[model samples]
Target: MLTRKLGNTGYEVGAVGLGCMGMSWAYQESSRDDDRSVDVIRAALDLGVGFLDTADIYGDGHNERLVGRAIAGRRSEVVLATKAGLVVDDLPTKAMHRDGSPAHIAAAVDESLRRLGTDVIDLYYLHRIDPAVPLAETWGAMAELVRAGKVRHLGMSEVSVAEAEQAHRIHPVAAIQSELSLWTRDALGGVDTAVAGPAAAGAGQAGSGDVVRWCADNGAAFVPFAPLGRGFLTGTLHSATFEGSDFRAGSPRFQRDALAANLRIVDVIRAVADRLDATPAQVAIAWVLAQGGHVIPVPGTKNTRYLRENAAAVDVVLTEADLAALADAPPATGSRY
Candidate 1:
C-alpha cells in the first residue's frame, strides 16, 4: 500500500484509509457483523491501511468500541482518528443534530477516549460544525484538548474554506474531511450546495473557496469521505433495491428514475476501469487520489475483499484521456444527501 503524510502531524499513513461508519451504522444495518468488522479492521492494519476513521455518532459509539477492540493489542501500529460534535437524536431514524459548544467538546473527548480505549487520540475531528455554535469556540476547545495532551492533532469535517481559516487561526487545522467523490466535487470548488449536514451551508457562499487547494496551501491534509459515492461508483449498485435501514433507500440519487440516469456516470467510469484493468471502485478512489498529494480518500467497507480491492487503488493510474472523460462525466441526477 502507498503511504502519505497526514497533514503536518508527522505521521505517515496509508494513502487509502478505513472509514468504519458502515460497519456499525448507515448502510446495510441488517448485514452488519461485529466479528467480521473486527477482522476487517485488523486486516486493514496488516495491509498497511493503518489510518482508522470513526465517529461517536456512528451507531451511537458502537463503531468506536468495535475499532477499539480490533486495535486493542496492536495500537502502536495504527493511526487512530475519530470524531465528535454530532449528537444522535433518533437512533432508528439516524436523525442527529450538531453540538459544537465548548462543554460538548470537553465532555465528548473524554467519552470518545473511553470508548476508543486509548489515552491520546491521534486525530480528533469536529464531525460537523454546529450552525448553532460559533466555530471559534468549538475549535478553541479542541485546541485545548491538544494542549492538554488528550488529542494529538485537531481536524474539521464538512467545513468551508473560510470556516477552516477561522479555526486554523485559533489552532492549526491538521486535516479537513469532506465528501469529494467524482460526483461530489464541492470540496474542489464545485457549487453543489445540497450536500448532507453542515458541509452544504458554505457552498457558493463568500469566503468558502476550493477547500482541497486551501488545505494543500495551508499544509493540511484533505481527507475525502464517500470517495466511492456510497458504493454507486463501484458499478455494483444497478437497481434501486436498498434495504429499509440502508441510508441510500431515502437518498435522492438512489431513487429509481434518478438511479437509472445516474448509471451513465458509472458507464464512463467502467469504461475507464476496463481500459486500465481496474475495478470501477478503484478508478473512483484513484481519481480522488489524483486530486493532490495532500489528499487521502477513506473508502469505507465492512467486507475484507472490498477493503483489499479499494486499497489496491494506489496502483491504478489514470491517463489524461481517462481524466478528461471522467471530468466530463454527467453531473449527478440527485443531491448528494
Candidate 2:
C-alpha cells in the first residue's frame, strides 16, 4: 500500500484506511461476527491499512472495544482514530444526538481511551459539532486533552470551511473528515443539505467552501468517509433489498426507485473500471485519491476479501480523461442522510 501523511502529525499512514463502524454498528447487524471482525482488522494492519477509524457512538462503544481487542498486541503498528460527541440514543434504530459540551467531551475521552485500551488516542475527532453547545467550548476542552497528553491530535467531522477556520484559530485542525465521493462532493465546495444529526438544522448548511483546498493550504489532511458510496458505487448492488437493521434500508438513495435510477452512476464507474482493468470499487476509491495528496479515504468493511480488495485501490491510477468522465458522471439521486 502507498503511504500518505496523517495531517501534520508526522505519522505516515496507508493511503487507504479502514472504517470499523459496520463491524458493530449500522449495516447488517445480524451478520456481525466479533472474531471475524478482529481477524479483518489484524489483516488490515498486515496489509499496511493501519489508519483505523471508529466512533464511540458506534454500537454504543462496542466497536471501540472490538478494535481494542484486534490491535491489542500490535498497537505500535496501527494509527488508532476514534471519535466522541455523538451519543447513540437507540442501538436498534441507530438514533443519535450530538453532545459536544465540554463536560461530555472531557468524560468521553477517558471512556474512549479505556475502550480502545490505549493511553492516548492518535486522532480524536468531534463526531459532529453540537448545535446546543458552543464550538469553542467543545473545542477548548479538546485542546486541553491535547495539552494533558490524553490526545495527540484533534479533528473535526462534517464541518464547514468557516467552522474549520474558527476551530483552527483556537488549535491546529489536524484533520477534517467528511462525506466525499464521486456522488457526494460537497466538501469540495457548495452547500451540503444532506447532512444528518444536529448539523442538519443549521450549522452544516453553511456552505463548505473548497474544504479540500482549505486543508491543503492550512497544513491539514482531508479524510473522506464512505468513498465507495456505501457499496452502491461497487457495481454489485442491483436491488434495494437490505436487512431491516441495515442503515441503507432507510436511506433515500437505496430506495427501490432511487436505486434503479442511481445505477446510471455505477454505469459510468464501471465503464472507467473496465477500461482501467480495475473493479468499480477500485475506480471509485481511486477517483477519491486523485482529489489531493492530503486526502485519505476510509472505506469500511467487515469482510476480509473486501478489506484486501479495498487496500489494493491505492495502486489504481486514473488518467485525466478518466477523471473528467467521472467528474461529469451523473449526480446522486437521494439525500445522504
Candidate 1 per-residue lDDT, tens place, 124-149, comes to 99898877888888999999999999
Q: Could you tell me how far off, in angstroms, the CA of residue 289 lies in candidate 1 after the best superposition?
A: 0.3
The most accurate candidate by TM-score is: 2
- Give the total clashing residue pairs for model 2: 0
Residue 82 in model 2: lDDT:
94
Which ranges in model 1 have alpha carbons more than 4 Å from their true place?
195-208
User: Scored by Cα lDDT, where does model 2 land?
Assistant: 0.91
Cand. 2 TM to true fold? 0.97
Give the alpha carbon lDDT tens digit for every residue of 77-181 in model 2.
999899998887777877677798999999999999999999999999989888789999999999999999999999999888899999999999999999888
